[model samples]
Target: MGYWSSVLLVFLGSCSYGVLSTFVKLAYQAGFLPGEVSGSQMFFAMVFMWGVALLFSRRKVRGKQWLTLAGTGLATGLTGILYYQSLQYVPASIAIVLLFQFTWIGVIIESFIERRRPGVEKVAALVLLATGTLLAGGVLAGEFGSLHPVGILFGLLSAVTYALFIIFSGRVGHEISPYTRSAVMLTGSVLITFIVYPPSFLLNGALTEGLLVYALPLALFGGVIPTLFFTLGVPHVGGGLATILSAAELPMAVFMSSVVLHEKVSLLQWLGVVIILVGIAVPELSHKHRTAAVRDRG
Candidate 1:
């Protein structure tokens, strides 16, 4: 796929993730525990992704590639579990801000692994994305006064794992078909998730009790779509640009909370969302302008 196409894939994947928190919150309100919510989502996602891979994917996994891909998926599963756990101790606003630290962390990983400093456009976009996240997540609105240490740690851990996920997704087994890669990696994720959360809901009739409602949407948006899209797109775009585009998640989260959950979003939050869009555009627009100028000179 082309660069722009890959960027779109990552952006859409990020937006799908943004919707996850809302559904999690809904599930919690409906009296399901975090383990139930996360485990069911993983179980359903594993089933769905494997089904698709069996039907449509043609790529074969060579020796040790499965191990590498599955190992990388540990980061994915940990990210979900840790982030969800953090929400139990901290305000959602604070949790989101901490989770978004992945933006810079991702850039740092790219820099370290590639042994190159990030370009000016990426730095600028990171600054804007961070600033906008603060406002959009209501961290600046004084709503997140509690800084629980455990929550902060879990949130930061999630950020690190998420950063690793972005980097590894691009660099490791990227030649594999997106379908096969997604299936294997998510299989690893589901294994780890099930080990930690223990899919007890499968035996206790939680699905019949209404957890299935949240599980299906969570699986599709959080598990399947992002996994497939990231596997397909991150390899092409590289990690740095992909991280910036994934900032689309924050604004979309804010919008979804406002629209779907009837959360009160302030004007500043709206402004932050706009700023985030501008930030996400910064690199793409700068690249286009440079391309145009070079063409003119040519």
Candidate 2:
């Protein structure tokens, strides 16, 4: 696949994740607890992914590869668990801003792994992304109320785990089929989720009691689409660029909140969304221009 195509996949994957907060909020309003909401989503996602893997994945995964992908899923599962927990204490706006910290965290992780400093384009993009997140998250709009310390902790930890996920999702189990890889990794995620929040939703009939509606969408957007897309795209795009592309999620989340949740998005927030889109484009546009220039010289 072309590099641009891979970048598009990652973009779509991150956007899919951006839609999850709306559905999660809906589930909460419907009276489902956080454990129930997260647990059910992972449960359904694990089952569906394994089904797809059985039908489509042909490559046999080695034991070590299985272990590695499963371990990586720890980050995946914790990201949701922690971020959701954070929302309980802080407003969604604050929680999202906290989660958006993954933008820089991801860049830092890539720098450490690659043993090099970030290029000027990435640094500039991070600045734009940070500025945009503050605006879009309404932090500068005076959205702050009484901020809970525990919520802030969960939100920041979620950023660290999410950054780890972006970095490792591209690095591990390269030879395994994306289908099989997503399944194994999701299995690991489900285990962590279940351990953290027991599977009481199963016996409590939450699935039959309206949680299934929310769970299905959550599983589709949060679990399946992002997992498979990241598995397919992140390796080709590399973690740094993929991290920048993943900023697409924040603007998307803002759009979803306004449209679905009927939240009032101020004009400044819209400006922030525009800035974020530009930030997402910076590295890609820079690379494309450089490539065209090199070709002209040749």
Candidate 3:
């Protein structure tokens, strides 16, 4: 696939994720608790992804890949739990912004694990992303009232776990098919969710109804599809580029909130969003330019 095609795939994946938050919020409004909503989503996603995997996969999953997928799934499930928990205490917009701190978390983790410093472009991108996130989130305007400390901590934890997911999955290499890997991960997530919240599936009331109606779609769009796409596409695009493209989720979420939820984003917030996009784009563009220059020189 060409570079632009890969980018388009990533964009579509991000947009899918962007639309997912609204469904989650709707589920919450319908009275589902965080753990219950999260558990149900994982369970359904596993079932769906497994069916898809069976259709597409030709090779069987090996023991090592199984282990990797298990670990990845556990991390992913816990991240979802933490993210949902944050939503209970904070606005979806704020929780998402905090979760997106993963962009920097990924960079820092990659640098430390590789024992190498980040390039100038990456460092600049990180700074811009950070500053822009704060601005967009209105963190500087003393608007932290909407943010709970516990929720903030969980959000950061989600970012860390997500970064680990990307790092470990990347290190696992590309031998395993995306279909098989997604199936394994989804199964692991299902098991972890069941273990953590056994009563969730057993609960009776409006919550279950909400899960069936609203959260199910959220899980399918936000939980299942994005994971599948990223697992497949990131290897082709590289994590750095994927991360940059995934930043689109932030702006897309804001746009969706405005259009669907009738939420108003301040001018500063929109400007911050623009700045963040520039930050993500600059590094990729520079890298592409340098690669072309090197090719020409050769």
Candidate 4:
């Protein structure tokens, strides 16, 4: 039941991210640049985090742990920046496919940590996941006129950094309260975002306009809630299963676009969604078989 509860936590976190892109698109339509979008989210997220930390995360962050958590948070910032920047040179379809590579990357990292190669079941699940991501992202149907080397580099970098962040989040600072750790991490994200896109524009009325237009939704859906859910849940689930569960975001996004944006989802896309969900369930559903295989190997 505890494991299933962890799965539910990851599912909820991934669901928040599923609807995040729509809010981001709304912000973009309101004329916010990527930097502005990222920064405003971070800035507002910091405020929300601070309030949450004060209320529940009363524990003070110490020396190295602060830096460690902050650094992991900064990696989250980079993941957003790199992914968004990649879209300038590549289609969103390709970029989405690239970001989803973190699924297998997480598996590899976990294999090393556990000092055992993943069984065939895990590998099959990853292949199914990648296939599903491609279909769900519309990469199978999108035209690619050109894939810029720089954009591809950024995309791959984002995937690696994202994988590392999940691994780090699950493994580090086990003693800290989730609220406090996530708040500290968000502060790190805010600093990194500010350094890249200075908030001086806010003094010139950008803040009020952005806030009025899109801050609350973006901060809540994209920033505060997802971070809180992932931080609170991943440690219990471990990085591998949590990462697999994160695939829930793509399918949820497809559903959201269809319902809210009135976008059409292709038959192939629906199929992909089903496959991804099945992939997420594979490990848990096949637990006995996997354990038997492990025992046989030993």
Per-candidate Cα lDDT values, in order, are 0.86, 0.90, 0.75, 0.78
The residue-by-residue lDDT of candidate 1 on 226-275, one tens digit each, is: 98999989988889888888888888777877888787889888888898
Give stretches of model 2 more than 4 Å off. Answer: none
Residue-by-residue lDDT tens digits, candidate 2, 77-150: 99999988987887665677788899899999899889999999999999999989888978786776568889
TM-score of each candidate structure, all chains considered together: 0.95, 0.97, 0.91, 0.88
Q: After superposition, how far is residue 262 of candidate 1 from its true place, in Å?
A: 2.4
In model 4, which regions exceed 4 Å deviation? 87-94, 145-153, 262-264, 288-298
**What is the C-alpha lDDT profile of model 3 across 148-243, one tens digit per residue?**
799899888987777676556555536877777877887887787778778445556544454678757877876688777777676666665566
Best by TM-score: 2
lDDT by residue (1-298, candidate 4, tens digit) is 2666777877887777667656665566677777877788878887988898899766788999999999989978887777767655654445655777888998899989999987776787898898898777676776433568887888788888778777788777778988888888888888888888887657768777754467677778777887888887888878887778787877877777777656667888789889999898887778757667999999
- Note the clash tally of each candidate: 0, 0, 0, 0
- In terms of lDDT, the best-performing candidate is 2
Better of 3 and 4 by TM-score: 3
lDDT of 1 at 102: 91
Ranking by lDDT: 2, 1, 4, 3
Superposed on all Cα atoms, the candidates' RMSDs to the truth, in angstroms, are 1.5, 1.1, 2.2, 3.4
